[model samples]
Target: MKNLLTILLLTFCVSVSAQTTRKYSNEFMNIGVDAAALGMSNAVTAFSHDVNSGYWNPAGLVHIEDKQLALMHSSYFANIANYDYAAFAMPIDNNSAIGISLIRFAVDDILNTTQLIDDDGNINYDRISLFSTADYGVTFSYARKLPFEGLNYGINAKVIRRVIGDFANSWGFGLDAAIQFETRNEWKFGIMARDITTTFNSWAIDEEEFATVQDAVEGQNQELPETTELTIPKLQFGIAKKFIYRYDFSILTEVDLNIRFEENNDLISTSIASITPSFGFEVGYIDMIYLRGGVGNFQNELQLDNSEKVSFQPSIGIGFKYNCIQVDYAFTDIGDQSVALYSNVFSLKIDFSCFR
Candidate 1:
């Protein structure tokens, strides 16, 4: 027991000291995948129980009694991009489980033009071409119940890939670890360390493709740096409580604190001070339907010195379940105004154990 506590303390210390100034190394990894969890503002680190938990907190995968598969899709950034995810989990025994998940985000048909010919000299529309930019990650996860009752631990190993048209490509690897505990009185707590080993992305850029504009770019006083990106670790902690009423209704409330260590000059340099808090609630009608809502990303208050509104992005969602299949829909907050702030996300989950 003392040894475990010591290890945890050391991990926390290392995470604090490993802060970097490199930003957006693997930024796409921060986008929440599952619609249900996003609708709840990513406050599920302690409450997640479905296959999608492989991404949120792999330790939650231990709750799966059988085999489950999940898929999610979103048309993000005002329909300018597409994001998709798929996950599967299976219990190995009463005490352990394994899972896999895939995430993809892409923006296609981007017009590639070195110079807008019409705006400059020629009127050649034929010079224009289209290409796509994409980011992808494959995650393998394992979870096991600890010897101590109500305690669980998990880990995730991931491979990340990114491409920008035919100009640049990057590949990287990362690992994540998490622990969760539940109390007899329906209270749950969890901690997740993302990119625990620090993800690194090494980019291979085609410099020849930009040779034509190289002198012009230099004339503009902009110099491109070498192509390596580092992603610092992010720590997430959550607490949740469930209230069951009668036998047909239940309500769960959860909150999470997120501390991200990055190389963002726009924010303060201290890891402990750069904290974001999120809150969420879920109400269930038996096991058939669910309603959820939450708020997130309000930490700007600290960076902005409270000069601007905290911009607490809010989301809402609903889910329906019957027999072996479940379907969910959510409206995730994406912008400042209602007209542009909300995006639709859909997900489907299936349990094969019921068929057996």
Candidate 2:
């Protein structure tokens, strides 16, 4: 008990002392995940014997009964990564359990365009022709859950790495700790602090070194610049409440105070202070038929542009559970400057312990 309290206090201290983002390059958390995307915020309150507990909330693992494992993957527009996550957990003596999670974030193939300029003193011609790509972050997480009375507490730590073509490559770590205060009678509360590492990694400008070379349509000989490390912060800390009625229908809501570190804000501020609240409701009975809907704000900036902010994409989803197997699906439209992202996604989650 003493050690648990110490760990919780330390996690909060890390978040308070971490340095935030200094410039461009924003970290995102809304890209993928079935439950949260579809708006099951109501059900996310408890640690059900399901796999998605890796993202929406990990502390729920403390409630699992039998041993379980699951993998979730999705194919998105332009071949961009929708989500690839895996997790497993087993009970430890009844009130405590341990689990592990792995999540990979990826982007679609991109064209790396370089302009070919012809300065003939009379007419200058410019044509962009190149191929490039951008992607970042690979995470491995470890979590442990312990129960106290009717409540549960959990902790997760993730190691992250980011890579974007020749622009930059940064590696860092993150930590999230949460407490699930609940009662079988009716109400529940949840609190979590994410990205406590404020990771700093090295980045090299391969293009900057090449920018000075004599437009020598013939001199491709100079080497690129050496990389330097930069530390950036991307953090989210939130609290939520859930009300389960008749032990079936539920309503869940969360209010998050988010702080982003970037070069600048194309929509708000380099260090913007914002509040994001999400809501979800579920309709079903006997765990056989289910339907859910949810909607929240999605960032519309690239690295740091504070000029535009639009919100209006409510999500909808449905699933079926039979005995020890279940299947899920959701539809969400996510986008940016390059193109409008339209996604009709499906998820296949198997919770073999479906009441086992």
- The per-residue C-alpha lDDT of model 1 at residue 282 equals 87
Q: Please report the candidate that would top TM-score against the real structure.
A: 1
- Give the per-residue Cα lDDT of candidate 1 at 292: 92
Best by the lDDT measure: 1
Which regions of candidate 2 fall more than 4 Å away from where they truly are?
Answer: 1-30, 35-37, 41-49, 75-82, 108-147, 164-168, 204-272, 298-310, 334-340, 352-356
Model 2: how far is 345 from its true place, Å?
2.3
Residue range 1-356, candidate 1, lDDT tens digits: 23433432232222222224454567778988787888898899998887988999999999999999999999976789999999999999999999999999998997655543554667576976777778999999999999999999999999999876665677889999999999988799999999988887777766654342342232322233456667878899999999989989999999998887643222233644367788999899988999999987763334445464345678899999999899988888755623344589999999997899
Go through the candidates in order and give each one's C-alpha lDDT.
Answer: 0.79, 0.50
Candidate 2 per-residue lDDT, tens place, 292-355, comes to 7765543444335545554434666777767766667665554432244655656555555665
The lowest-lDDT stretch of 10 consecutive residues in candidate 2 is 11-20
Q: Single out the weakest 10-residue window by summed lDDT for candidate 1.
A: 10-19
Steric clash pairs (candidate 1): 21-263
Report the lDDT of model 1 for residue 184.
Answer: 89
